[model samples]
Target: MTTRTAEMLMAVVMGLFSVFLMWKSAELEIGWIPDEGPGGGAWPFWLSAIMLLCCVVTLFRWWRRATPESRSTVQFMDKNTRRINYITVGSLVALLVLTHIIGIYFSIFLFLLFYIRFVGRHSWLLTGILSVASPVFLFFFFEAMLKILLPKGYSEPLFYPLYQIIY
Candidate 1:
């Protein structure tokens, strides 16, 4: 497909998703309650609202624009670009799926290493640093500051003690 086609399609999909999020968030009540912070749906509601606005603006521009040059001209999806795009996106999706079985932080480390070293052809040193640092940063950020729980998956049993110490 042409680049315009892709962008248009993405706009449509994003708009639809934004609508869905707004609908769902509205059901949960986005407003904050007395003495309580924003409701469960506040973030999704506002974020989706912004997304919807942006999508409308994007679509309007696409609709009004004339030539390909007016937009961010997309170079033809050459073989290399296609391959790299596929590999990177595929790795991300695979990581998401695998996280249910393995864990989030672990999968991130593995995926980053694979994508950088194998797909993007970066150095081993870079891969090693990223693989280790990404998860460590996530552990501190999510667990320590946010106090949010992440899936440990199968690593739960093996890594629970580690989490107790870190978190």
Candidate 2:
């Protein structure tokens, strides 16, 4: 499909999804609770409501051909670019699956190595530095300071020392 048609179709789907989210969130009470600050569903409900509005505006723009995206009739990507896109998307899916097995931080490190070294054609030094540093930074930022733990899978034991120090 042409870019314009594809964009319009995706917008319609997003609009429907937003409507569904708003509907489901309403079941948990979306308004303020007087004593409580905001209801459990307030964030989701309001965020979905805003998303639905934006989708509606996007649909209107698409219908009127008011935006450049709506006016474009070009094919989305050439064959080589499409191949690269497919590979990138497939690798991300693989990474998600791998996360379940190897843990999030390890999977992220591997993904960074793959993306930076192979796909990005960057220097090994830069790739190695990033692959190691990013996950460590995330571990400190989330697991240590924020007190939010990410999945560790079977590699949880490896992180015990770091955790002991941080905690």
Candidate 3:
């Protein structure tokens, strides 16, 4: 399949998976209790249901609008950037594998450093800024504002002080 079609099919599969998750979660008690807040998987279940619906809509629109011309181009992106693409995607895959193993901050830091330094061939200054900034932003956004706890493994305790302060 062409990349566009492959991507869309993957999205459809993801949507179906989300729907299955929502279905499974629905089998559990999902209502808010008196003392406790939302029951298990309230957000994920509902949000994923919404996402599944949206994906259905997207699939419908895509089916209606997609043309043979769109499928003709497999080289939508720059072929010369293959190495950069592989590096970037590899870093992301590694980050996913490492997120629970070493935690978010450390994994993201490593990923950012690799991308900026090796893939992007950027200056140390830019790499330093990005390596420091992105995780901090995500930490505050998820851990502080959303009151969600991410995995804290290996040297993740280093951010405990910041986490306590922000939270």
Q: Clashing residue pairs in candidate 1, if any?
A: none
Quantify all predictions' global Cα lDDT against the true fold: 0.85, 0.93, 0.79
RMSD of every candidate to native, in Å, equals 7.0, 5.3, 8.5
Cα lDDT tens digits, model 3, 15-64, are 98988989888776678867988888787788888889887876776676
Better of 1 and 2 by TM-score: 2
Best-to-worst TM-score order: 2, 1, 3
**What's model 1's overall lDDT?**
0.85
Clashing pairs in 3: none
Q: What tens digits encode model 1's per-residue C-alpha lDDT throughout 24-82?
A: 89988699887988988898999999999998888888888754633655654878889
Q: Candidate 2: lDDT of 49?
A: 96
Q: Clashes in each model (backbone N, CA, C under 3 Å)? A: 0, 0, 0
Candidate 3, position 96, lDDT = 86
- Candidate with top lDDT is 2
Please give each candidate's TM-score.
Answer: 0.56, 0.60, 0.50
The weakest ten consecutive residues by lDDT in model 1 span: 67-76
- Candidate 2 achieves a global lDDT of 0.93
> Against the true structure, whose TM-score is highest?
2
